[model samples]
Target: MLAFPRPASSAFYRPDIDGLRAIAVLSVIAYHIGVPGLPGGFVGVDIFFVLSGFLISGLLRQELLATGSLGFAAFFARRIRRLGPALMLVTLVTLLAGYMVLLPDAANTLGREARAVVTLSANHHFMKHAFDYFNTATDLKPLLHTWSLAVEEQYYLLWPLLMLGAYRAGGGEKALRPTLLAVLLLSFAACLSLSYSDMPKAFYLMPARAWEFAAGGLLAWLPLRHSRSAWHANALAGGGLAILLCSIVLLDEHSMVFPGWVVLLPVCGTLLVLAAGGLDPHHAPGRLLGSRWFTALGLLSYSWYLWHQPLLALGRYYDVGQRDLLRDFLLGGVLALFLAWLTYCLVEQPVRQRRWRCFATDKSTLWAGLAMSVLVWLVASAAMYMPKKYPWPGYQAILQVKQDQAQLPPGCDMPERGVPLSPQASCRIGPAHAPLQLLAWGDSHTDHAMPMYQLLAQAQGVGILRRAYHGCPPLVDAVPVGEGKVRSWCLNHSRAVMAELASLSRSGLHGVLMNVRWNGYTALPVAGSASITGLAQADAQGNVAVAGAMLAGVGQLDRAHSLQVMAASLDRVASQLAALRLKLVLLAPEPEMPLSVPECLARRGAAACHASRADVDRQRAAILPILQQVASRHANVRVWDPIARFCDAQTCYAAAAGVVRYQDQNHLTASMSRTLQADFAPLFSWARQP
Candidate 1:
């Protein structure tokens, strides 16, 4: 291993280091903007981590060697000055923009994120929320990038103190090197172990990331020999750059095993560049990095990093047209540069120069900075609460609709899926003294119709025993499976529902209502069959023979064999219910909206909320025939199709008669479900006859 030389008494400015910063910041920006050929540009953060460790450790080591002590207060004050001003300005600006443009839920989330960012706990907050850094939803969060800043700030708090202790111990630098090396090894081991099991910890937590920083600190302490060979210096620097380029081009957000062993590519590459540049600044690589443009970009990198994300997030929030994506990217890039330059000149430079000398003292600046952050937090909090205090008419209408929809009968809010519910635990909706006239069972689709079921039960003076397990179908034999594993919770819930239905039938249950998102099971690739994508492509091209052959080769009747199995299981369940003298009603799947109803209404109005008939037909085609087939096979089974109530020949209305029909894409809102109570009059009349 090549040993890095210890720093001299005076610290010299390295333009090449700034040039590396330029590369780091630009790569991050490019990735955020969805630039092609730079899928792993996010590794720039790892580069920043290494650079921070080296630079900050070198400064601390120099202080210790010169004064034989470390000044904690002074060091902390310097950090606050260096990082606080631009961060505060950017956060405040971003919050203000969010308040002006974002919807209520999004604005509230932004406020919470802003508070987390100011406290330097954004990483923990994101980890607690299970916010995957690579998820598409992360693009909506303006402050998501600040998680790295929080990690660096947290490191700043503890590292100096640890360095102070190490320097005070016997054999100063000698003891410190070994200690840091141990920490580096332990942290790297923990990262490797945790990345597989708890990726969020590996991604966000300080301990898992400490090794990179330690590598830099160790490099700072190692002795370097100045080599006269130009080829050697160029080779080291060029190799490092090649590794960085390869990482940027090859790896992507979808690579699950990231920030684990894979992180070494960028980390080691950064180390090589730092070491080579330090040993021989006159090398070709050093000259390229120290060029005027690279150094200028390096100077503005910090502010640019802060400015770019919010602009991009806000642009995305507005739902920029797909055709305009490239234009938007270029505009955002330009805006980011303009804002970064302004912030660097106006906020960062002024603060560092101490132009406001009255509050220039270390203690005063720290307190003042804290106060500014607190003020920004208060403003954000106030803005987040604005929707509640002064609600928009459309928003208020939606809220009232949701409120009415939530007026479900007793025990409607059952424990969420995956939680164990007793086989005896049931929600009774309707007249209290009435015997149970109906039993409803399935997944979230059944739960979504609770309001309508309650309405029907009350009108007929009957009771419903509602038992639902979201994500689990009503079929006993067909367990919900994903990624080639049977979901134990779903399987357990299905068995429990079966047991409950049998008990209910003995206690005078008149009928069983089966509702589920049938398409979900049907869409899955058949076990031991061709992949869904391959089957879909073949089917789309109208190659019936090829598709048939593929299915036959797998010993499957059709691509939707899973759905067939589920239908068969339902038939068995219905027969058993009929033996107990109970009727069976299989509610046909509703026409699913293409987008969120409320969001569409709020953004594009009711006219645009209707889904085209072709889209609705496409969604219903596969599942409808299977439901009809099941209904025909059993004498007691009745299929209830509600498509005509919300859809016509032209389009499926997401909002009908001035009321939103869907809570989301697939589920009926409570209010809309209640409106369909009249459609179930026949079922209620049947119950009342008895």
Candidate 2:
């Protein structure tokens, strides 16, 4: 076989490598599209991670050993020459598709993703938004999977210099082994530690990812550094293959903390196979992975990886709320094959052959790619984040304090709080004298609802006092985000909200308005990522008992018990509002779409969340039982149901006379809330309070 020109060597194209690529690609596809019977399929990407480290490090290491001072510029030029053309073509098409098909918010999200993609920081973005992996807020984000590419790029940026520095600073190739081993061990240990403690961190962070790549690096460097017997290589290959097979077939969903320690199985497996390359073709395990068909897929693997995620994400994007695992998998495979063919022809072959060598050699050319990518990233970021303008000018400073506790209280166990207060964070409602003061509070549920509350308050003399805790629910029934540590915060915040309510009730204040979209106490976000064998729903026996106890606790707070607390609060606020009668109203939160808004918005046609009156009726009926019960218990509470006011026989919608009602489900646009006030504010005209 003639040595084909790979940067590392003029070596013949390895066929079985494609087989490994096929294995990796298929596994990731199966895993992501929610195909049954392959829960561990995500490990396929781990396979790619290992392979990439080995190949990239192999090339770099070979050059370093062959030449004293590495040709870093040529090395980078070759990478850009090889990977850039295909990547740019794909990204441009994806961005174009984003502009057309995506919803406004989805477009914003894709814009952010575009920014992250161009900047190569998608891993960090995903990690920050990791808490709600598929929250209603982010379910339709098409570029979510680009985190892997970010990881690869991150590894590429750091690893080359580290290897080069190690080679130069120490005993060259001979001393390189221990340095790599130590770094690998440290990274692997970090992964192991995070896996046991923080699942999300382990899943996304770079430290946790280093070992897999290092395992590959070590494998690539091994054979040249030391000689091993044919029997040793064969046994290594066979054992490694067995480990890989066992992991895919035998492992279940129970051990999801993978690519941490569990990744060793496959990384070691690949290592064994590569190490065995010095053997005869008939050598058992070596021959299998090295087979002609396997190598073909390996050859096309880069194109395949580029093709698969977009196909799968797009398929899910189109499907929206509906999950069709099998169909998505099938479509994913077909689209991948199609894309891989196109990429191989249009990008991979031409670029790899340096047909456009003129651009590759010119520093200005690479600089152009970088400059364009950065400019696009900046523009996309600007598009995604439109700064919020406060309706009331002076309130901006008050609302600007970023709320850390922006979600639900952890376990909702506070026994001390009698009246309920939403754990809503810093909110600047209308001036202290605003006759109508509406309070929006909860977890981020509270945070997201603030715009609607503000619009309503501004028009209705309703002052909006915003307080939201992240992961802390407004409901005493709401559980903490994860486990025990959160329970204390949940209890304390609930206690605070309850105490605030008691004080307000006694202050003779204008009606207190409250809003929270309390579904998760009974419902989970629609994404399949959140799985529970027996999540206690609202009507669940255990949940009902808990709710009953919570109500009983609130009911126990009589005027006599709250007198001292209320008097102190009244004294403090008397000068602020000066003896104005306080009215309490429970704002009936609009119903959310059964699916995420992006998922709903991504709908091309009428099945989009244009919830007809019938749909509102059904939703209201489902949650009415809980909503009314809560409202009924509160003293002097009035219902501000958007359904009753906004829906008129046919549909509850954005076209509510001169106002665009919804930015998305369950949240009203600022303008819509103001418009609705035109109709509803007169109802508050009867109030004698401030």
- Note each model's CA RMSD in angstroms: 8.1, 10.3
586: Cα error in model 1, Å: 5.4
Total clashes, candidate 1? 2
Error of 2 at 166 (Å): 2.6
lDDT of 2 by residue, 66-148 (tens): 88657766766666666666766666666665554543455577777778877788888877654323232333556676787
Q: What is the TM-score (0 to 1) of candidate 1? A: 0.80
Scored by lDDT, the top model is 1
lDDT of 1 by residue, 345-421 (tens): 77777777677662488888878778877987897787678855665444665455444444544444445454465
Poorest stretch of ten by lDDT in candidate 1: 529-538
* Top-TM-score structure, candidate number: 1
